[model samples]
Target: MGRKLQRIVEAAIIERIGPVTAQDLMAMSDDSWGLIRDQITDRRNGKDGLVARCLACECEVYIRTSKTRGIARPLFQHYNGSDPDCPWFQGRNIKPDAARAAQYQGKQESNFHRLMCELVGELAALDSRYIKHTVGQYRSPTENEHGRYPDTYVEWDDFGPFVVEFQMSGTFQTEISARCKHYEREGIPLLWILFGLDTATALPQSFIDVIRRHRGNAFVLDQAAVAASREQKTLVLSCYLRKPDGRLDAPKLVRFDALTVPRSKIPYHEDRIVGSRLAEIEKVRRPWFNALAQWEDRYKPLRDLARPQSLLLAAAFSIVAATNGKGRNYASEHSNISAMLNTYLSTKVLSPYSDLLKQIIENTRSSSIIKASVHDHLRRYRDAIQATNESPEWILLRKLLPEALDPVLREELAYLDALPDWANPTSE
Candidate 1:
């Protein structure tokens, strides 16, 4: 390979979003690219953010912009401190602090940022429930750590304490993560408001980071939001909801109190990331569940749908649904799930799925199938058939029942604190 090819990172794997190449990055929409760019920054900072690692050397990588004909393009670049031995290493890189200083030119806070902070504080104080509001003041930690200088701090009569940080220019991912963790540790609601959002054609990576932390709901205290707050006697924000296609919807004026504050302390009106994804997964499986519930003949519907592996999936899902207390037998007309499983095992239809079935049974709620009878049946039929993870049936099952099958996804969901109850295999 040439020196340039060796230096070019061919691909990278982003946490939660899988693999992407330079071509993939170029194909992404502006908003999508912005989110990936911010996530790369976050991963470089620490373990708290989405991790993007080079597929070549498995070292951390970030998105670097290269301009061609006045049009900016993105490519993956290893971090400055990454392993120098990696084939994709691009010579020496500048330190993050130096780059940040050059970008800001020693001006950490702009006048517009200060003015916005004061204005947000003023609007927050308009509510009758507002007890006190402060701007650019030190907020001492309630516990053992040192305090932080929040842009705006507000204490409500009944709603409790809140902190608002305004995004002006080039807020580092480490700083953002530290502040979020700090406020969450102190049990204070932290809200990040964006400035100059109305004028930007494409959002900067820093703004994208904040928007994603708010779960795809970007809040801006713009002129219209200011007027709305004045009329409503409370803080109002111009909320822009991100669509699935990585584009923003029309801005809507939302009251500060109307936001949904998750456990992360970052609030949003709607969850466009996690909630929407789960809903999509449900939508994909709903028809299968419906077909299974109303199943008359197994060979016709399961075979005619899509993959030949649907029969195994339907059988597995039927067993799981029965254990979940749904009490519907879709695999067979047998009186119980145990009978259906035994029949399949004897016929070698579910023989390749023994291991998969055992995992599902162990993860779900208590059941008669958990008794030794089922295991005995599985063990008896275990030697009769070959089971492999490389099979299409196994792969499909992992995608269909990720909460139960995919350990990496399970860990990711648990780390986000969004693991559903059905996915909790150890609930017993």
Candidate 2:
């Protein structure tokens, strides 16, 4: 069997109304269509309400609901005497791929596409900052830039024209690259919003590749906003993005206007640190601190060995001690730990403390005291920096230390670097 017909048209006394899809008619709803029929009906009442028309030629048509015999979906049908030349006048026997390809190349937009464009355009108009800016399907003002029209364009005061594209189907990678370069040459920023349905499930490779070119890998929309729009008949346009991870981030609504710069900081709904995982990490915090403290207690006897070596070890010990059995103190101790590590890395000639530093590094592998101390310290430092709305690149360096260290120690450092900063602590 062939694919069911998805497209239809509406008829008028003098002209035809559409090549509109059945989905578009569904979105218009029965009540809205009833009003349109009442306003446009003939005075003599001789016509049989609003007449559905054929796309290729003017011919009266009828609605085919889901219950209609032999039809798997809602559609429009023509009477026996309808136009023979009409492309869609025949029943569902056309080739599926051919029909789909034609649909993509056709001028008619799908219901989802039209709705997305309308919502974005509506949001753009309501913002006061863009009140004077033109918002719609933008036609470039110059003859040289003619035929270049974005799906949704907002001419802004500060940034000039901002072009947006909502991609719902498969796209070519070469086309994606060329379009980005074209926009760059034109000095316009092009924002791509992937179809919410696809994004919420799995992103297409084309969308993924294009977004990666823009220095990001994730794009998300709030599920709540989608629900609210269905009920309120208004568009609340906001999107959240991040570097693509293996897992999807929590869904939450944000202001649509926040995406002004493609690479600017976009806030997430929840702090990445406050989940059940953090609670588990908290369980190990004290034990880690205690181990580090005990290590310091044992090393105190070495303070009289030599001034240079003793001072460096003492500073390292002091830094770990300041953590105070809590992850919160890691921020303040960051500089001390950094200075000690830098000094250790800079040491060229072997000395009394060289073996001791190697021992400390080795302990980071099997010693719970060393591992927990490092974990809690880095976690606290991450929370502090993230609280300031900054990326924690400084703490990330813990993962990049020289390979001369034990592999296990390097792995632990990498683990610390990878932990998510879910929530910012209240105290510094």
Candidate 3:
């Protein structure tokens, strides 16, 4: 939604419960989102009134509806301002005498080297470009020195040599200077994107004079412009060229930052709450199943597979599987619920995996992820794990299963076991 439609959108849409509209917001990663313009809630009777287009770019948006389909895509795309000096390019025409240009390119290349060293765990270091973060000083470290690589980058898509350095929120001059020097010495090309909440990076004349002294190109990323680029998904794997004067133009933007949420946020609680916040999540998420059940209704015809639903289901599970004094007691005393809830409000609201709230329950019963936290999320789905530990279902589920009963749903089995003698899974 844009500045004008903000209030109107607030009025029209009902989240996670009714028919989702073209204007609703969709989760990108845990950190960001892209709004849908002309969203296609349903493609009815061989014709279409549902269309999602990006407001900034005015591009059409689409989503994949099939639970068991291939290549499902959301229709909104976040606009990342174009990279006037991104590291992906090989440099159009190298001039032998343009030594400064070569030096800048080297800085870009070295920065890519550093970025990959950081991103290596999850993404491919092909062309050996990725970002590595560290204390602004002291001994430097590389990703390789750490351990096994990251799962997302290793298994899924690849990485590019260009690394994006978000100098927003925390770009202390000292830290910036140190990081820049590190890369400069590394002789890699870097896309130094800088910005503040108020606007894009327009380096001061003094700053430009300083950059002119450097061997690299720095660009600024415009958050507002990027937020407006919701044509297909909430975000993109792209970067932008910030005007040195810190001004932003809507059209010449780049979309970047795919997989905005880390794998860590996954295996999250599917069913968090049934309150207003949850309702808002649903209004944007609402897309009813064929059974005529509201998207929020638990008894829809199909099994719960949406990521959002899965998260809720996981929370319901935690209500039973909880134990006292065991895990992150994000909620314990009623006073604490506010803090925990706030965390969700701040983080879960914009997370792409938040959608996993729908698909999480299904994933919990799955073998795709082997981490115990997945079980933990499901274990304490209702409240905090530690709080729910004493839940009736938790005790019973543990009693019914053998030591580690993962193959068959140990939780479900426990529920069945807790039933009276007349009722059992065998009865099914």
TM-score of each: 0.63, 0.42, 0.22
What CA RMSD would you report for each candidate? 15.5, 12.5, 25.7
Across residues 1-428, which tens digit of lDDT does each residue of candidate 3 receive?
Answer: 22321111111111211212222233233122222222244432244444432221223233432222553333332223423232222123222335654664555434433432333222222223334333122333343232211112221134432233444333466655554444444332233443322223444553442222221123332333333333323222223223324443232333333322111111101112112322553353234212212234433422434443333333323321222112222122223322332344244421322223323223332222223444444333433222132444334323332222223433433321222111122322
For lDDT, the strongest prediction is 1
lDDT of the candidates, in the order given:
0.73, 0.42, 0.30
Q: Where does candidate 1 clash, by residue pair?
A: none
- Model 2 local distance difference test score: 0.42
Mark the 10 consecutive residues where model 3 has the least summed lDDT: 5-14
The 10-residue segment with the lowest total lDDT in model 1: 103-112
* Predicted candidate 2, C-alpha RMSD: 12.5
Residues 1-428, candidate 1, lDDT per residue (tens digit)? 32333356765656545446566677788788888798778766774667777765667788888888998888888887776555456764423344644434322234345656777778888899989988889878888988999998999998998999987666898999899999889878899987546433777888878888888898876546776888999998889998887678888999999999887888998888779877877887777777676666666757455433556777678767765677666777877778777888777767767887787777655345455677877877865455566666677777777767777877756655566766665553
Instruction: Evaluate model 1: give its lDDT.
Output: 0.73
Candidate 1 residues lying further than 4 Å off, grouped into runs, are 1-105, 108-112, 136-149, 185-187, 198-200, 297-301, 305-311, 319-327, 332-349, 358-389, 406-416, 426-428
Clashing pairs in 2: 9-53, 271-422, 272-422, 273-421, 273-422, 273-423
